[model samples]
Target: MASRPSISLWFVMAADLATVVWMYTVGSWLDHTSKFTATSTLGGHHILVLVLAALAFATLAVLALITDGFTNTTPRLSLIKNLACILSVVALTGLVALILASLLSRIVFGRLRP
Candidate 1:
């Protein structure tokens, strides 16, 4: 028989799903809005988006690796890793959201730059 998932598991799943929704919605919104501006550090929207996605992936992966390595070893490390994981997930969610938003913009605004 299959086992039931715990509350924490459900929470995590819900949170992750919410993150995806937020990203897609925000992306759509930003794409339609005319007031948003790009900073020099982030460059133009297209390049900034790719950079954000890459950063999000890098941060989540690194934190996950650290958490995996510390699991079953130390309590302090476990707590720290968990915190880092949470933070990375949030950051990743935001960046990914931007990427998704940019996708909508690209589709509407044209993909090639003149």
Candidate 2:
């Protein structure tokens, strides 16, 4: 008989799905707003790249989590999981910083009108 998957696995799957949905939502919003000006378009493009990077890191984290879950005996899998976690944190940090900077620029420069 097959064993059931772990609860952690379910959580990871849900988080990944949420990330994809969020990426789609943000991309749609950016596409709509980017037509306002060259600066907004440029900022939107940068934001899209950061979002994609975060998603990629999140994917890597999920893969590592799954691999380590299945083969907990291996030291290599542990290393991969650790690396993925670290990279995911870094990606998230960069994404947040980029977003804050974009918002601040828009506010200070009065570009928020668009």
Candidate 3:
């Protein structure tokens, strides 16, 4: 029988999705707003880069989690797998930070930082 996802997993997925959306939306807003007094910092290329970067990082995090789910008896592979675990933690933490900052700014400043 197929098992349902744990509540923690559901929360993790929701937070990750929220962060990705926030990063892109805020990045785009900032890019556009910069045009008024400053040169457009994040133009189309920059937006693409930010989006791709977030996706890449998030993918790496997911892959890391999946890889850790395996159990094997190889030292070299274990080392690489451990590294993936570390990278995943870092990526997830960064994403969370970005989201928190965005949320706080919206709540306190009443603007989306654009």
Candidate 4:
């Protein structure tokens, strides 16, 4: 008999999928908006949104690590472990991209001053 994938695996997969969709949406929005103006600054709200996205990615990466540790102990669960690894890499990649985008935005717009 074959064993079923755990609930936590499903939860992590769903959450990672949602987070990827959200990051893509925000990235698209940024690209669209950037084309309109040569010099534009991110407002406090925009910064807040970016920060939240980063946190989401970080949280997902941590969850993936924890899930992988707790659930992928048996040889039968190798597939799940691989999937978790991929999800963690994706999350980390998104986090890096977000950080790069923030740095580029700062360079382009200068520092946000009160």
lDDT by residue for model 3 (17-92), tens: 5545655567556445544311222232334434544554465455446544233224654565446444334435
What TM-score fits each model? 0.33, 0.38, 0.33, 0.35
Task: Please give, for residues 15-43, the per-residue lDDT of candidate 1 as tens digits.
Answer: 44444454444544443454342221122
* lDDT (C-alpha, whole model) for all candidates: 0.45, 0.49, 0.46, 0.49
List the candidates ranked by TM-score, beginning with the highest: 2, 4, 3, 1
Higher-scoring candidate on TM-score, 2 or 3 = 2
Superpose all Cα atoms of candidate 3 onto the true structure and report the RMSD in Å to 1 decimal.
Answer: 8.1
lDDT for each residue of candidate 2 in 1-113, tens digit (9 for 90 to 100): 22333555445445444544654556456545645422322444535544544565565556546565434434665565456445444434434554677788878897545
Better candidate number, 1 or 3, judged by lDDT: 3
Model 3 Cα shift for residue 87 (angstroms): 2.0
Cα lDDT for residue 19, candidate 1: 43
- Candidate 1: worst 10 consecutive residues by lDDT? 35-44
Give candidate 3 misplaced runs (Cα > 4 Å). 1-69, 100-114
